[model samples]
Target chain A: MNDKITTPQTIVLIITTLIGVWITTLPATLAEKSGPDSWLMVIIGGGISVLGAAIVTSTGRQFPEKTFIEYSVETLGVFGHLFNLGLIIYLVILTGMVVRIFGEVIKVFLLDRTPIEVIILTMLALCVYLTRHGIEPIARTAEVLLPILMLPVIIIYLMIILFNGDLSNFMPFLRLDFKEIIAGTKATVVSFLGFEVLLLFIPLMQNPHQSTYSSFVAILMVSILYLFVVVTVIAVLGIVETSLLIWPGISVLRMTETAGTVFPRMDVVILSLWSIAGFTTISPMLFASAFGISRILKAREFKSFIVPLVPVAYMIAMFPKDVLEARKAVEAVSNMGLFYIFVVPLLILTAHWIRRRVLNR
Target chain B: MKGKVFILTVLIGASIFFHGCWNMMDLEKKTFIMMMGIDALPEGQQDKIKVTLTMPVPRQLVGAEGGGGPRPETPQQILQSTGNTVYGTIRQITNRLSRQLYFEHMTAIVIGEEAAKGGLDRFLDVFQRNKDFLRMAKLYICEGKAEDVLKMETEMEPLVVTYINQIVHFNSSRSLRAINYSIGKVITELHETNGNSLVMRIRPEKKEAVVAGSAVIKNWKLVGWLSDRETRGILWMLKEINRISVETSIELQTPQKGLVVLDLVNFTNKTKAKIQDGMPVFYINMRGEARIVEKEERIIKKEENLERYEKPIEQAITKEINNALQKVQDEYRVDVVNFGEHLRKYHPDYWETVKEKWDLMFPHVKVVLNVDVKIRRQGIFK
Candidate 1:
């Protein structure tokens, strides 16, 4: 179904995809590595991701009417099929870990008695339903849910900064060691891994040439939001305490008390709204993976492949035995995702350049 | 059409089975704990510790008349159980009661002197790790058994928990004698300072509970206590003072002296550290503004400068600060004024050299104080 998505819809898709389960634990990871300089590391990481997104978008623009799966075959022949298989595997594993982490967090904070298997299956069922509708519907759903996901987050950040923020927690500014900061930049870049969805969505845009602008705006928005999250969490909890927490974002919200108001506890409200964010993030990745499968098999409708992939994702989500193991699994999958997002795009561009210039085809 | 009907039937059936019924519990099936106290059991007892939980009785709270034969004297129920661990003790208490013990609404947690002295590191994890416990609850160290503080009666408030919570909020904002330290704040401070910090102190009297002063903790164990005046001094050094009255006798003429009380309205302080002779020297500068809130005698003339009253107030503050410094530095030898954190934040390189032996070198470090006070207003007569 060659339904076109507008520039604004593309921006919304990329923004929601970039923010997933990673937002809750990002501050703790950065605090453990860079201390008060976590905000600076986020900026460095965002700058690098912006450059990587630029490369991916420009490559997609080379063949305006073709998706990544289509153009890779035209440029590298047999090698492109292998690369396409790598992309599908990365997306499937990424979706699995996202669903698993979301289930774990909900079980801890909201529902203690519900089985985690029930949580995973329910979320996967919803994702499958959304993926069966194809790209235009997924983009529309993100456009509708972006405000619901962001307004509470922004309000919570403001309340924490106004009530409990301590400015001295960021003291001895910029005294971080050079090597430690470089190491932290690597972790921060992994949190920015979901932007690679642009490789599949660029060809579906109404004007594919504007993909660069769409990618820049989306990454800028997500980066500013992440910076706010890290700064507010560290400012309220301090570096040492933030590092000790599993979810510093939720902990910061827990510390805020809006007494004499209608809502005495805002953490529960913010978390319920955050479930919408989790749904938006997971559906887009599932859609991209199923679409890739349909293209490889020469099928006209991607809907046929959507149901079978659900059980595969369910099995992967259940692979990790515990929270610690789940984190290790996510790290392994993210490293593989980095290869597809960064190295593969550059290789495809080089092959296309050689074919056009040297072979004079 | 048949496939759509079958899919809809499956969706409806799944929703009926997975609608969060597994975790649902009715309000009547749970009991809300208002406050909790932990005390170390007496020597030679079977259990190591005792936990006391206070829950309000709903029938007594609403003053319902029909169902009860005779109303209870108190509106709350206090239950105590002894066990080896906190969670185990809670579960043991649950075995006797029909309703589950809920901690989401708990207002305060009081730790007894003996338990605090033993070490708090073991007891803090249950509150931090559990989802039911609230992080905003005020934490207190009692002078005696925590059970006595929870058992104390109040004339104004119906429950001791509400009484203690109100006093803490009021004193922390209007007076320097007490500081409100939430469990979340204490956890952060304990982690940052290696368990060297101050927690607000509470003591149970014959008829009431008093919330004042503070208890000093070193390496996760209670070391000593700071009195109200000394606590004010530590508050001044930490810049935690909001508004307090300073009373001192000022020289009016040669033979006559009068007591003048100044209301401190504004305060600001700056601390700087430097290394000299292999030791760290700290210089603190304090500036404050005050108004004439009360006076015992007419000691001010219309033409007399208000600046004359500034010197006595400054000396009074400096004396209070010095007394506190003497007790914390020489006697207890603990750094509760956050001097160690200040050094770590402003001087990271120098901190790296002495960070290992900071506990040994803390008491030897020298501190210099400078106070600047301004009397901005006088009484109505002036």
Candidate 2:
């Protein structure tokens, strides 16, 4: 019953989590703000995210054997319990938003007549099953599924670039307005929010010292993939058309025509693969929240908490009235995630530093 | 054992919910529309549009096995409906059909001249928004009503849409006159240029359809048309021309006149823009290699220089390009030559200042042309 995961598994988990439903809309979101300079915004956003991940990982490495809840309780005394609850709340809401968006996309593209509630509930059931096994099984599932899901997507992107890409669509390059690019950078950074899961998983890493390196490598890999996706989508569809579509990534796949091949269209194939990607993304967050609840209740096993939280997550997923409102809710949660990713880690590091200095005195 | 039974019950219950068969319609019950045509309603009609959907009958398309009898003349069903919006008309047609109308397999979309002139953004919005619509569908502007082009019978292929698609695919690659403008490409171009772009034109005849030239779209409305020769000239400037043959008559030193057909084997151009006195001036350098494909008379002597033949060919190309440039710039007042795009890519600062009034300034911009044509081969005959 050893629960430790290898560094490679952690890296895979990070990559799959960072690339949820957002990758499908990142190009359009970035393009809407920065026009043709969206690629530059992605690079800037990735650089900032790498910095944020470094701080969170360094904080987690300080208490290598304890989870984030344990370390927070030890650091802030009474407030630590409240902070742990906040973190769990954030993770629960995030999982709900992710599942809701996934259902929305599946309904629009694949199953036009399926009710959104059915889609949400089924996805939650699968995630609950995965989360009940704890982090080790979730990491194992991600390790086995990342390559199967990503390789085809990367190949299709490269094919589109080779056959249909127009380099001139990236014109008016490097001519970004300062204000617009700053706004675009903020939006792009929100997409990189999932990498903060390292704060919870770092304790489970067999080699805690390499946690920094693993997180860095994972964020870099995701950044490169994001860069490729954004560039290819913009190059083929152009900035104006890309910014107009709700799901520009899927639209790009739909427009791609692979002549003389067995499968002329690839949107269906890519979407089926993306459903797996969505599973990997939400399961980790679900596990984090359930594990946090068990730790707070002083229970030995997190499995019992998983089922009860499913209804909570389902309720939150159904809270949004429509797609537009769901998007707004996701953005609100992402902004809160920014606080936990940046401010909470900085608070812990400063408090730990001050405590050590006083002990030395 | 009790725990195991409970887990098995939950798993079996989950399986029922996960199948997601609610949206599934049997393949036999779905009718696939191969082509869609949009036209303006006839004058004094209540609805704004007339939509035609062409669905292929699979049984007739496959033909009878071992039965040596005449097949149905038209193996496709054409249904028409009228409504105010594109989606409404489609739904109106769906009301009468026995099976669900599917548009995923659509090959082409033809818009009549009246519809295109009224502005295409309204008609194109549904195609852009709906996921079932094919973005790769080829878009063409019919010379008259789109229904005429959709209903025209073709002896070459059983389906008229496939025939039109093949004609577009063949002519776009082999000739410079026809451009292969897919829905995706046209939408991107229209968005990039703010609704100023070009669309391939299709003209319906008595029994067949002709796909050639292009319709000039300005501000989302069809403003004018470009002839085949003019389209070729614009293609040359836009660097979209491929495998085009040029025919020119040249005078020889032997006091004989001959008609020379030269195949422009390799052609490339470089366009440079510079701002002078608040106006942009373009410098175009055109270089190509030509091989004589046909000759009416023997005009080349053993000792004659090949450069003599290259001069007339270059002049003819320059004149053709100028004619197209003049028509687009002066008559149409459209900048289909991509000078605005070129300036935006190379000189962003200069473009930002003039992009607002580019249409006004495009007609006055001076163009300097440099042509270098090399006659590489004089054919097998001396």
Q: What local distance difference test score does each model get?
A: 0.84, 0.85
Candidate 2, residues B1-382, lDDT tens digits: the string is: 9999999999999988877565578998999999999999777873499999999877767766654347554678899998999999999998898998889999799999998988999998888889888889999999999999888887788899989999987776666577777888788788878888889999999678889899999989999999987887787777454223333222222224767677775677778888899888989888878776666665446764667777777788888889988989999998888898888888899888889999899998888888888888877877
Model 2: residues with Cα > 4 Å off, grouped in runs: A257-263, A359-361, B1-23, B65-72, B239-256, B299-305, B378-382
The regions of model 1 sitting more than 4 angstroms off are A257-263, B1-23, B45-47, B63-72, B239-256, B298-300, B379-382
Top candidate, metric TM-score: 1
Provide the TM-score for each candidate, comma-separated. Answer: 0.94, 0.93
lDDT of 1 by residue, B102-142 (tens): 89999799999999999988888888888688888889999
Deviation from native of the Cα of residue B275 in model 2, angstroms: 1.1
| Candidate 2 CAPRI category | medium
Per-prediction count of colliding residue pairs? 0, 0
